[model samples]
Target: TEDVEKIKPEFVRSFQFENKLMPSTWIVIRIDGCHFHRFSEVHEFEKPNDKQALNLMNSCAVAVLEEIQDIIFTYGVSDEYSFVLKKDSQFYQRRASEIVSVTVSFFSSMYVMKWKEFFPQKELKYPPSFDGRVVCYPSSKILLDYLAWRQVDCHINNQYNTCFWMLVKKKGKSKSEAQHYLKGTQAQEKNELLIKEFGIDYNELEIMFRQGSLAFWQKEDKNMPHESKGSVQNSHKKVIVEHCDIIKPNFWEAHPSILD
Candidate 1:
């Protein structure tokens, strides 16, 4: 018994590691799909934007919020999602690895489980996986800016992909040809090209595709009947999804509780 105890401490000391997130800050755990481009091609996913695929991602996000109460918000696109834990959250003792692992594992499992719900006709070809990382923002403004950056990235990528796909799918150009055609094209040029060649109004495109999806709590009903004091605790949150501009002040003004 003495030898076993001495050996355990000597071995565990070399391998034990824990990186706690900074206190009084917002924690963002982002997960992106691994090799999803090849996976999407293999599955014949609709190009530029796949409604069902995005829907599946959103569903997994909703499930994450329902399961992880500390996570107050999530922003998700095609193959990636970011979970934002509250500023004062002590989830998993603020350990980065635990938080990242829990969220990523649950999200990946939910994605696999809900695949059939979104794609009933198509069988899942193979197991899909996600990679995750954790970062902490020192202030709310910085955190919001991080989200805005992601939204802007979504807009840029969607615009490029829309043009690329239009050229390839509609004009019958090869992938390389499409890339060459769209090369050196600015946002205005791309918009004009879409309008003139494809009769597509970029502004009228789906908001989710342009802005990605943002999910957050919608304030639980405090007036609801409860059997006892213990039952008054938040049984569940009212999580809502929006596909609108979070880059501007309008969204934050409308939902101040999201930051509160």
Candidate 2:
């Protein structure tokens, strides 16, 4: 009890500081179920032991980490094998969409492959193939609150739920402004009233961002004397937009393939 008391204050302080620093940090959380069918198919193949379960969990975490690394350049893993991106700067619409799509596809593929490799003869089946849903919000506090709620739901429902959430922010907006825009009464109402409001076709944005457009450039002389001839130089900085994640009820339902 004494130790808990000592830690509580520190934890609160840390959270407060984080909220202040990145008030508008938006998180995208993807929750996936792993090897449900395989587990049932190979129920008798491996003994139900804590050590074995832990080993399997560790392996799954490693696989997820590897896949995430392959997709996103800037990301970190939490202790729970969940992925997080803090203060992410790459907010180009294309980049954001690519990150989400690649992550879902990669995780789904690797999860299936890993299960097959582990239980070669189990003949496991996957539910309708659905990618994990992405939840976006403007504040970490709200994100954590939503995660906690989902955790409770999973516990009560006895469902296999694995989540990968990313924190994102718009490039130009101040953290407070972003948070205000996301959390304001009108915005919240809009989000609540609209079904599938967060759903977006990121692939289209990805292709558009990749296509470069023309821009004007000035010429400068290099090889010739300063007065002789002029040379031209062209440069472009990728355009990126900043945005955050918000919580949506029944995110798993959005991706019926994985959930089913």
Candidate 3:
């Protein structure tokens, strides 16, 4: 029994590679679908924007936020999502592999579990998987910039896809023709095409399509009956979800606690 208690500690220590994220920093774990183009096609996702698929993704993200207390915020577009851990978090000792792997695995599982809820009529041909990576930001400014970059990318891609699908679905152009027509066209040109050809104003498009989805916690008070009749109990904090424009200064100002 004494020898069993004195077993070598190196046996466990050897398994770790010391891939720890820096302390006093923000940790971002981003997960993206692998070969999702084919997956989306197989699932018969609507062209340009699939509301059901996007909703499914957002639901999965909500599950992640509810499960992982350290993740203070999340931003997701298309088949990718970025989860931001609180700057002072010590989850899994800030081990990069452990945190990234577990978060992505949980997200993937939630996606599968909720798929039927999102798409009851459609059958899933195969399972889906996401690849994940971890990045650390030393300051709030850098993290803000990183999030802004993803929002900008969302805007650009949504604009292009909106035009591409318009040309294909409504205009009766083939996929290749739409691609060729969009080639070498600037954002201004795409906007003009949408306006002239499809009578669509790019700015008027849904914010969720142009700006992506932002998930964060909001504290609210819910009144409950106390032990005594007609007496109110104390309020507590609850995490709620929101989909809005995070690129604006107002959003950052409103949720100042997220970065802290």
Candidate 4:
């Protein structure tokens, strides 16, 4: 029994060297699905955009934010999501590995749990996994910039994918031909291609695909009435989800309490 008790301590204690996230800094844990392209195809996801899959991802994100009390905001697009923790949070003693691993694990599990709700016709086939990392931002400005950068990436990639998929799916162009055609195309050229060739205005696409999904804590006041009496009680605050653009100053200005 004594040896059994000591069996794992030596190996387990070795993990104490894991790096902890910096205190008094923004903690961002980003998770991205592994080999999602093949996964999407195997599951018969709609090209360029899969509303059900996207909604499933957002649902998982909402679960993470709801379960992880310290998380302040989240932004996601395509197969990736980033969760922002409060700057002063002491979650899991600010352990980077624990925080990142737990968030990703929870998200992956939730995704699987809610998959049937979104795609009732498709079988899961195999388990899905996500890779995650924790990044620290020293200032609010840098944190804002980090989010803006993700939004910019979402816009660029969506535009390219829209064009590439359109060429292959709608225009009968070979995949290789589409890739070659888009290789040197700029944003303006992509816009022109969408408009002139497909009669689609790039700007008219769904904002979720172009801008991505953003989630933050918004306080809602609820007046509770005591069961014994007929009088209303004090306001109770709750958080709700919002999908919007985080790159603009107006958004940050509108949610000033987030900074506090």
TM-score of each: 0.92, 0.36, 0.91, 0.92
Q: What lDDT does candidate 4 reach at residue 168?
A: 99
Candidate 2 stretches greater than 4 Å from native: 1-24, 33-58, 69-83, 89-96, 125-128, 159-260
Determine the backbone clash count of candidate 1.
0
Give one digit per residue, the lDDT tens place, for model 2 in 197-231: 33433223222121111111112333433444463
Position 30, candidate 1: lDDT = 97
Cα lDDT, all candidates: 0.92, 0.36, 0.90, 0.91
Clashing residue pairs in candidate 1 (N, C-alpha, C atoms within 3 angstroms):
none
lDDT, candidate 3, 1-260, per-residue tens: 99899888999689868898999899999999999999999999997889899989999998899999999999999999999999889999999999999999999999999999999999999999999999999988899899999999999999999999998889899999999999999999999999999899999987778888878776656677667676665666555656677767888998777776
Ranked candidates, highest lDDT first: 1, 4, 3, 2
Can you tell me which runs of candidate 1 are displaced by over 4 Å?
1-6, 220-236
lDDT of 1 by residue, 36-125 (tens): 999899888999899999999999999999999998889988798999999999999999988999999999999999999999999899
- Candidate number of the best lDDT: 1
Predicted structure 2, TM vs. truth: 0.36
Better of 2 and 4 by TM-score: 4
Give candidate 2's error at residue 208 in angstroms: 43
Q: Candidate 1 — worst ten consecutive residues by lDDT sum?
A: 228-237
- Model 3 RMSD to the real structure? 3.0
